[model samples]
Target: MNDVSYSLKVFKQIGLLKPVAPHRLLGAGLQLAKWGPGLPSGVNAAAKRFPKQTAIIDDAGEITWSELAGQVNQLTQALKERGVEPGDSIAVLSRNHRYMIVAIVAVMQAGGRVLMLNTMASRSQLGELARREDASLVIVDQEFLEVAQDVDRSLVVLGWADDDAPDDLPSVASLMAGQPTSAHAKPSRHGQIIIFTSGTTGLPKGARREEPKDLKPLIAFFGAIPYRGNSTVVIAAPLFHSWGLINFAFGLSTAPTYVLRRKFSPQQVLQDVERYRAEVLVVVPLMMQRMIDLDPAVVEKADVSSLRITASSGSALAGDLANRYMDLFTDSVYNFYGATETGWVTIASPTDLREAPGTAGRPPFRTTVKILDPDGREVPQGETGVIHVGNDMPFGGYTDGNTKSFAEGLMHSGDVGYFDEDGRLFVSGRDDDMIVSGGENVFPRELEDALIDHPDITDVVVTGVPDQTFGQVLAAYVVVRDGASLSEDDVKQYAKTHVARFAVPGRLMFLDELPRNPTGKVMKRELPDFE
Candidate 1:
């Protein structure tokens, strides 16, 4: 058989080979018929298809598709009056809320690009982006409005005030009421979207992409999980991150009634999933770990039976966590592996986890992966090399001119990993993060995974700092499980038993928590230096 034959066979095995009924296809058409260049078309299409259906639910209340379209029109007209034009930037700083969604759609309708500011960013960083991006307007949540004070005075600032009664700052409700609802023309170019990196090591870089192009990548994703027009989705990930933004984009096309929360906790997440009967739960790996940490009695009380897909992405899902999630959720856990730069490279299903433990699974349809050494030679299976990928989901490069290295036709993932004999991908760590202690290369994940195997250790991070004798020895930072006691010697002894002598840490430190960015990535640069 040919490559296409093998891919189609796998798709059939994953249940994508099923036939679709005529009305369901019609329903999909109704939701996507008007989806032209801008994202507003998707919302308009949804409203036209199911005007009475619930579009979004938040702390404030729910809005129907028709009501959402009206508000989007109102904001769009108001933005037109304010002179928003094609290719202009509309910077946003807000938590997850109804008006934030309104602003995003409205700006695009008025032919402006969106710069989703990180609500977790400091005042200085927010100010810098607004000025640097040359934003024509800055939309702020009242809570984040203070951070916009130092931004360029020429930029127009609009505030989305929450119900606490702020007399100052114009509210989105007032702006929408000021304009008339009417159909708008398409922009000369499709409005682009910009998402920033987590900036764990340095300043966050912006990644911009053109309007939606291919459905193959999206279809490939849907093949791995059940995402459809009628499904309900609960987005626990932050809106500024790629995982959250992409899921939200999928919602726009599918017209799913989505549930969003301002803050995330294990109990809150479980409660929302139960209350809404959400069929899909999209989250980062840390959120799942917290959910797993919840009391068994509390977890038993929640009915997660409605969820068909619990997709984990944006970070590595450790093997132990995968087993724990599957043992509890019963094969619903699907782990996706990729970076913001490369899109999705691989996806691991419950069966894949059961067979190979920590594998990142195989490449999806139309996606290719190659493991190469420093000289760009193809490394044999089971030997670690830099992971590179090329897929239909094209990366349009970064806002900053600096680019990650590329070889052949594939973009470098900067990740170190190897492929098993069964063709499953195993990501070790970032190539830059690899440690060379006493001339023996070490990937911290190897030691960290071993350390976390201890019952008392809830989490562990290993970093390499400069050393005189061994030239950059390993230092361990640990988070002890609650009500658990641990000593440095105990940790070292446990490590010695689980790993090699050189992989053992030279020193150990305990912390209440590891410092992480918004995407739940550990900030090793922020860790204390023993040197």
Candidate 2:
């Protein structure tokens, strides 16, 4: 589609094309003009346009757009008063809640770079990352106070705290109290947002993303997802991850009522969806699986008919899982494939899931995806090669001054995939994950996808282990469903029918559960070796 038509379509999808009062439009424009296009600008615009609209509904209570904007302004002023300067790096560690949202926006308004720390990180990891990122200030939830305290920083603030918060430590609510609700002065520079890699194999590295120069990136995203403005969205994914963070930004534009929870509970999520009549549900595949695995009676009784979209990302959405979720939820599932370093590469819609299960679907508007051989040449269709992608918002490299492999103006996604005759992209596995066993190339994802479909298996992870004869052989770590007995021979027999002869796992290890990071990506490096 042409640029004009594409932009119009995206605007309409997000409800920006709807009629609005001239005065409110003018006010929103003025606010954006004053603060520029960061979170501060978005929040202020939303407040101006829909002051009475509900902005956030968390465990504490609901807050209107006007109230949220006021709190953000007050907290921004307080952060500046506490010596936060432009270009300063501030690390924030907290779960999904009003306090986390306010702290992030406040930091951005203060012109301090925001580093979103993983809530599941170890204390040592947190401290090391905070120091490495040169964070001048650390804001943490009450639960992570000790972890935040261990980090070396000039200032430590409580993002969320109880009434009995320490007298010495300042909380977001405390800072906002007795402060002016007016907008703060615009910072000299726009703060950058840094999201870390999942770090399944090693220590996480920070990926920096700057404010977009144009609406192209936004258009690319909105065009792919069906999100309407003025709707309620339940963000079940962790805010620290890129998927959740991007959806939050999307919410700022659409002015949707956000429903957040400190921790993810499958039952609570379903209850919230019914309570709020939420139109959108954002989650990772793991969370979706948990929700789908809930009691059949509970799933049937839940009133999720109001939901229009159930978006999944941050990890692979298994084909079987997607089919099962759709069968139960009536085809609202949308799977997004991308990495911290590469933005979104592909999005699988309901039709894509139904037509060709396991395919990553296709690229969205203004996105370029190609399968490249080792020589940096585009491979033939249906030929497996590394995936390379180019989008309007290219990653700004890593905070540590490193970058992903780039070729022909595209960044390497580090994944191997191919395009089918119908143009759907099917990711085989990580490039480094491909193993040569008995002189035949094997991708563990293909085997894992096959193994996960077993009736007795709840989860599975396949990896390569050294073998004296084959150089490296496949090892399957299987997690059987509760009360279900599964043996290695059973797994081998199942795989023999589902996969190629050589692809059958040579060794098997049964586990209660597979080790995974907070985002639900399997930690292959953490799998136990064969005895």
Task: Give TM-scores for every candidate, taking all chains together and pairing residue i with residue i.
Answer: 0.92, 0.98
Per-model lDDT? 0.78, 0.88
Backbone clash pairs for candidate 1 read none
Best model per TM-score: 2
- 30 Cα displacement, candidate 2 (Å): 1.9
Look at candidate 1 and tell me the lDDT of residue 67. 92
Evaluated at residue 126, the lDDT of candidate 2 is 88
Worst 10 residues of 2 by lDDT: 146-155
Q: Candidate 2 on 213-319: residue-level lDDT in tens?
A: 76687787878788998999999999999999989986688889999999899999999999999999999999988987899999999989998889889998764
